[model samples]
Target: MVKEAGLGAMEKPNHKHVADSDLISPAKKAKKSEEAGCDTEDPKIPSGAEDEKQEISGGEEAIAAVGDRAAEEESSSCVSEEKKGFLIEAAAAEDRGGRQTMEDVWVVLPDASLDFPGKLRCAHFAIYDGHGGRLAAEYAKKHLHLNVLTAGLPRELMDVKVAKKAILEGGWKDGATAVCVWIVDQKVFVANIGDAKAVLARSSSASELGNHTEASCNPLKAIVLTREHKAIYPQERSRIQKSGGAVSSNGRLQGRLEVSRAFGDRQFKKFGVTATPDIHAFELTERENFMILGCDGLWEVFGTSDAVGFVQKLLKEGLSVSTISRRLVKEAAKERHCKDNCTAIVIVFKRE
Candidate 1:
């Protein structure tokens, strides 16, 4: 069973993009594309191709329409550390913020072994930030992971494309940015498309074993585990131009969408928007502390450094992962005054 152990608050959005008088408060928590094309038609990825793939190097052709390189089915780099037996814990949080509808959806499956049968022992976490409507977000939350499970749960990198392709199959005019993580024993796999981000906090030698004081917190490094995929990026812009797509003065694809890679943006697929995720994998060590998975709303006001420091401080104060996640969401929505729906998940790899 997927032990949603410390699940704080996760709600089912009405799945709309309109206002509601029943908008919930922060104290209570909960949860939750485009286009067509002319030149490059919609992607026709088969459902059972998870096995016949090679790990594509990052930044070469992560965009689906950019090349024919198939993504691998496992983490490219994973060193065994199962002997460490790190205690992993996770929690979730969300807020409507200034938005009428909550368009962010997330899931935490602490035991993904059932989904993969007799394969690797795995745990999964994901966040999807939706636009145009909450349908894409809701649909992706419910079905994307299932689709991935059906196709063998993706190696490490190619999972988001499966998610985006499944969401687009419904011919919906919505889109979503995805950030997902998988923990298989001591190995960590981070995958993302669009702007939703995953940040890992690594403690220094002193911070890992020292007292949870300000001095111990100062040495923590916030390592961003995923790349932002927006049209403004040089490589992304070049691909969009080559695909016969145009970026406006404001850096949006065809003067509409900002992210050059996402799910369910069929209209922008030919415009160089892709579903391929940049997957990163590594083995966890003692220096690793925790991870934060959040949408752009939280990121808009919370820098990676700011967030890591904030969480570390709260942890020193003896806050649980569940409370820390809720506080993080409130910090982004209330204190930071983010005008968009905010959601976050904090996963602690080894809690001392």
Candidate 2:
């Protein structure tokens, strides 16, 4: 049997409290990253910044401080902590017997931003889908934030693609799809891989908006995140078949690669199938309400709109993200009629 990621109950604080125990200064939260037990490391900075390194104490302290000030400035400058009204909740459940030893992993980035006081103006979130095993998913969970926080990614991800190519060509196991969202320069960029999905909800009614707007129904729009690498998409399927791999049931080449793009799965390269992620970047209006990061287990059962609706209802009833995550998994387990491991992280975005 595969060793599961343990089932110990996650600690959550009551939502009604002003002082949540989970609430810690951003610096302390960053330090906890090193202790998350997944060999997940701190965000990497650019080379030749030795002068900046000297400005700080230990290397670990430098990393712990990277995004700490960002959180504070955003709080004192943009929003007030007392009026801050957004919540992020996450949950994971594991079942050992199904689908390659249950290697799926999920994480919620530290809630340092809760310090922002204005009407919860920004939300950052991510979802990773693991394949071939859970290592790739776990790797992304640990590294995605660091990558974003890291000083210099080529503005176009040209370096990201180049590095990925080098890693795969050298025969690395990069088989997870990642979808990440962060608010910068007043717009939202959602980047993705594999089939893991990120969804946005727009208020549909004045009632839904808590009387914030006069519009009768707020619209829910899907801000597309990562593109899939399965062979089923016509262009991708054609590429696989043309490359000499057989397209099997449902138009997927080789019957197994359901997505047209992915982060790992090196064996597919023989047919010239490269494990590259298709990143989608876009802006969402400030009215955007909520976002969800879930594995295919949820997608296999819920439509994009259906999920947004379900979560919106839950939030209206005063549920936290952690509660939402648990319910989503429970719902999937029920619908699938199996002991499938399900994990989810949800971010509820609100106006201050």
Candidate 3:
């Protein structure tokens, strides 16, 4: 069985007090790219070894300090464009959580704007899974995309590490996991922090099979795009130990948070927790089918291959992307009995 970090009990704080300033001016929040001394010309960020050392503090002051450091190390990049021929779809279902079944947030931008006049004929999908409270996730859902757009599309999209750093520095008091995918031209870019994940379905022989018959068609394979930042991972465990944080015998950060990296979580910043994201780029081909982004709630119940194969089976039956997404969440909640809030976004690339 796949071991995942459990969402422990946490007190909900005032959302307005936590994220009001960051959400009001989405453009302004993103514009900080300039103030951070980020270069608009080059978007490729240097490797992790060069990450700046941040000072430890408390409350809002710590958040401000991290933001200041993130700005100085930030960079941007752009992507080429081709005619768009894709169908995008997304849906999410929530498990009961007291007064609300909320805590999960997603964004879909089929016609996202680029630095130039004509919009980039690409699509962007993201999922933010909040822990403790919804303020950080809710704030990221509203402003992270805008920040990506403001820093310049395509180019900045590839610089997800810097973008995530910016979001963390944006004054969030809680923490949340994030996973996002950007489809541009014939390439797909994926970036993620913490455990929320993105998976791609690819089939080299898909074009050869004309019909949906299972026997005649090539099987779709799951390609996990992002690595989970859990304490069980050796590198993550080492990093926490070096930073004076302890990993429990059950594999949790300081025997508290399950994830080693996340947005917000001001309390854990001093213990080596970060918001840096892992970014990967893939060239699109005829074999490509679709992609899925979901929180740990879904992954805990389904492995990467299991989820991808289920979606492929549904596609063979000619089910729509929207229907597949809704069914995925429902199954996880009901059939698998996922205890946490669940959400998923599916983007299908139609072959013509």
Candidate 4:
């Protein structure tokens, strides 16, 4: 099990845009697409086809040989340390809807040398899911890290309890969900506002399971690092109600915003909606392998354990990080059939 800590907050400028509540009707359910299956065939060949088949096979082999050589050269040139102290792989994939731009923005800063007093090297990763428009998501992607870094380092922003106070004080507009992960040495810090999520996939320890066997294979466990802030959550709904924000019959914030927390949405700020994030800090163990940060579009269709299992299966097949991430986004888009944009980032921690 993953241990969780307190929360934090950040602010962003606001913008005017239609919240997701406007796009989706509460009464309607999205249709799930059927899984496609592959078809295979073995056709009979004539006696004279042997020579022709050999000629075609030789040509195909030659082409494949050239392609392999090119791939090898390209891979070598592209390999580099993403950050000064860590060897990491990161990738993002997005699928947009017809009317709107992909309202998903992600960031991967492998090495952010802060101006802190000590030898502090922080690697930051985040995903922002924009609701009304791309402005909030884009803005958060660019500024959220800076704000967190400023609060965490030079200013010593260590008090997590003050997150709510900061959000109430900050002025922000349009709304967007945010999930962030900051790595300093072996410690990992995570924060989230709204439904965007962060999950860690690692090997389960024998003690955690309370059982052990020498021949048993250790199972992989999915650790949800962030809590989703939506009206559906009891606490969130109560907070909204107390703040004069009504949870509509359709389960929206004042029948406008679907999420209960976000970076912008100045309109909902007074109604109890907040930009405060649930923050957690923990040390990364050798058993930990990778972490995933994704927008709700992915989570809507794939559960935490399901997503982790899918990625782990792909990793065991020797798939690269980028390929795994892109596949996940595509899978979510196809499965969810949701009108919302989809985005995901996969970060693999290499053994030093």
| Total clashing pairs for each candidate | 11, 23, 5, 6
TM-score of candidate 1 on Cα atoms, chains taken together: 0.71
* Best candidate (score: TM-score): 1
Rank candidates, TM-score, best first: 1, 3, 4, 2
For model 2, the local distance difference test gives: 0.41
lDDT of 2 by residue, 42-102 (tens): 2221222211111101011001110100000000001111123332333333332133234
Model 2 CA deviation exceeding 4 Å by range: 1-100, 110-124, 151-173, 204-226, 242-244, 335-340
Evaluation by TM-score, superior candidate among 3 and 4: 3
RMSD of each: 12.0, 16.0, 11.4, 19.3
Candidate closer to the true structure by TM-score (higher is better), 2 or 4: 4
Model 4 ranges off by over 4 Å: 1-86, 97-100, 114-118, 152-174, 205-218, 335-338
Task: Supply the TM-score for candidate 3.
Answer: 0.70
lDDT head-to-head 1 vs 2, winner: 1
Writing each residue's lDDT as its tens digit, candidate 3 over 1-352 gives: 1111122233333121123222211111211211222222222212221111211110111111101000111011112223545444444334432223345556666655534443345566777776545556656666666655554554323443443343334332235677776665555666677777777666656563223345125556666667777766898889888989888786766666677777666566688776666556556666566777887777878777678777777878887665677667667767887765666776766644
- Number of the candidate with higher lDDT, 1 or 4: 1
User: Lowest-scoring 10 consecutive residues by lDDT in candidate 2?
Assistant: 68-77
- The runs of at least 3 residues in candidate 1 whose Cα sits more than 4 Å from the true structure, single-residue gaps closed, are 1-84, 153-174, 206-217
lDDT of each: 0.59, 0.41, 0.54, 0.53
- Model 1: lDDT equals 0.59
